[model samples]
Target: MENKKANKLIDKILENLDKTGINTETLIDDIKELRTYALEEQIPLVVKVLRYTYEHIEENNSFLIPTLDDEPLDEEGDVIEEEADSPVESLKYLLSLIKNLKNKVNISDLKEYRDLLKAY
Candidate 1:
């Protein structure tokens, strides 16, 4: 029951968006179902999405920056590559995304990811 409700709610949220116009009406019913389930279940649906968003953000932010190369660029013009994503900066970006979503997620929610980034 909870799964069905959650699925419906998530569907509704997706459907109501302009990007989801194709299945708009279908999602509407699911969204209503999800809302009822959320109210009865006392589950924070946004929290789950927030967690996923944060993880995805962290992955996207982890990239190679071509600055720490041991040798200068050759005739090909390829620079040295070094890992990017400074921990503090990454955390800031994650916080910004969460802020942009108008959702409140505490730093502790991403503590493990932050710690891993810090190690980098």
Candidate 2:
């Protein structure tokens, strides 16, 4: 049952893309704003956001998700922060990520802030 619905949704999305001249990059950038905002009890808000952004995405046309990877880990569970491009911006990105993931798990390297410092 779900597969049928999933296929329909996928087909509809593909149909819309074909009808509209939207490409992969357009979809990516359009949906990027939704990368932030932790999932909470606000199910309706989430749905509304997805709908609003996806429907009116082109007008917004900016803001990437600040998603980051966990810092490398050693056998001893130590974090190995790596230097990312544009240290200051990277640091800010990590800081925001840390704020979100702090309660969930121990992100020791703070998304590689220390590694970025060493490179600086």
Candidate 3:
């Protein structure tokens, strides 16, 4: 079943998160597979996040990790440049977002958006 397949993929992803070094290519492939499930399930938020994350990683070769502060100063008082997240950190962050997605998105709102798109 699709649910079983999705669960297997999620388990794989979670396992990878615990490893010392993550294989990004495999992770990306897993994400793509999961995105298909999201599309079939009509979970717009998951679909969008997965698509955007995939495109971003593919196009930029890096994940967009936001900095905690707009301008961070060291003890010397000079502004510190923000550092990019490692692939593993990026994966973890993505997983967290996906896990909390239900709380953040309303299914009714997504349905309304879909309806609006159909009207156009």
Candidate 4:
């Protein structure tokens, strides 16, 4: 079924995201494939997020820069900055956002996230 295919693709994407070195090209292709299913399922939020992720990786050769709040706070309450962008962390954050939207797509929250993503 369509859901089964979509779930399989999602699993594959999650696994790739967790890998030590991700192939950006492959990941982008996979995301594009998943977007088709999301479109068919009428999940506009997922579609939009996936499209953004695809475009971001294609253009930047890296994941989107996560929001500052997504950064960890050190004991001194300062943000723990990374010398370079962490694609894994950003991808995981994207997945978390998708998961949250899957349960219930809140219009206000969606707008907020859209703005946040656009700011990047």
Candidate 5:
């Protein structure tokens, strides 16, 4: 049955996790990545087990799904929180912030630029 297959997938994931001593934070991040991969790969039960783990095991206090209350605040501390932002504006803001940071630190070398890129 479909339920048995789902349970087997969940068991396999747990067994794999048990074989390593990954820290909780890293494990959470890895699981999230796995969920995304499963969704992209069209694995139905893999997605279900991930959802269950995120909902019941993860300490995020809420399930993996975003709730209505998850929103961004405005200058006046109000949540306008549109569904998405313009990619161009996002990249511009990020570049401006990096430029300001680089100017503040006087970091012009390629190594420092790479480090800053990784930091953000």
Candidate 6:
């Protein structure tokens, strides 16, 4: 089945990165499992994470930024910490993660997440 929403999401991410000079190809590599995680949770993974982050902040000013430690090191082979010194830095890291999600996986695999995002 054609997944227009997934394609759109990919497009938006690409648009956002258009002039950032970020190495987008390396950002998105193996993401077949992100779809599975999204399906199982029945939520657009981004929305879910962001909501939890907002709620956590409202309930408590402190938070530990979510980690992708299970994933491999970044293109630079540098460790991405689960913590950031400030909210701006944390947001940047989260955006970077989203940008990286734009690769390798088929739209069919991303259908559920796309739908979740649409309904969101």
Where does candidate 2 have its weakest 10-residue lDDT segment?
33-42
Model 5 clashing residue pairs (backbone): none
- The per-model lDDT (C-alpha) reads 0.40, 0.39, 0.60, 0.69, 0.41, 0.40
Please give, for residues 20-99, the per-residue lDDT of candidate 4 as tens digits.
Answer: 44578788898899889889988877788778777877888877565334578899999987665477776765655554
Give me the runs in candidate 1 sitting further than 4 Å from their true place.
1-22, 43-103, 106-120
Error of 6 at 111 (Å): 17
lDDT of 5 by residue, 1-120 (tens): 123443344344445444643235555555566566557767554455445544343554322222112377889999885765432232223222222222533223323423333333
Q: Sort the predicted structures by lDDT, highest score first.
A: 4, 3, 5, 6, 1, 2
Off by over 4 Å in 4: 67-85, 99-113
TM-score of 5: 0.31
Best by TM-score: 4
Candidate 6 residue 101 C-alpha distance from true site, Å: 2.7
List, residue by residue over 1-120, the lDDT tens digit for candidate 2. Answer: 123433343344445454654444655443333323223323333334344434443443422222246578989999986665442243234333323333443244442433333332
Q: In candidate 1, where is summed lDDT lowest over 10 consecutive residues?
A: 61-70
lDDT of 3 by residue, 50-102 (tens): 77666666665555443122487999999987776566665564554454345
Clashes of each: 0, 1, 0, 0, 0, 0
Give per-residue CA lDDT, model 6, range 1-120, as digits (tens). Answer: 123444354454445445442333432321233333444545465545445443443444433343222444778998665533453343344444543445534233234333433343
Estimated TM-score for each candidate: 0.25, 0.28, 0.57, 0.69, 0.31, 0.31
The candidate maximizing lDDT is: 4
Model 3 regions more than 4 Å off: 1-4, 20-22, 67-85, 105-120
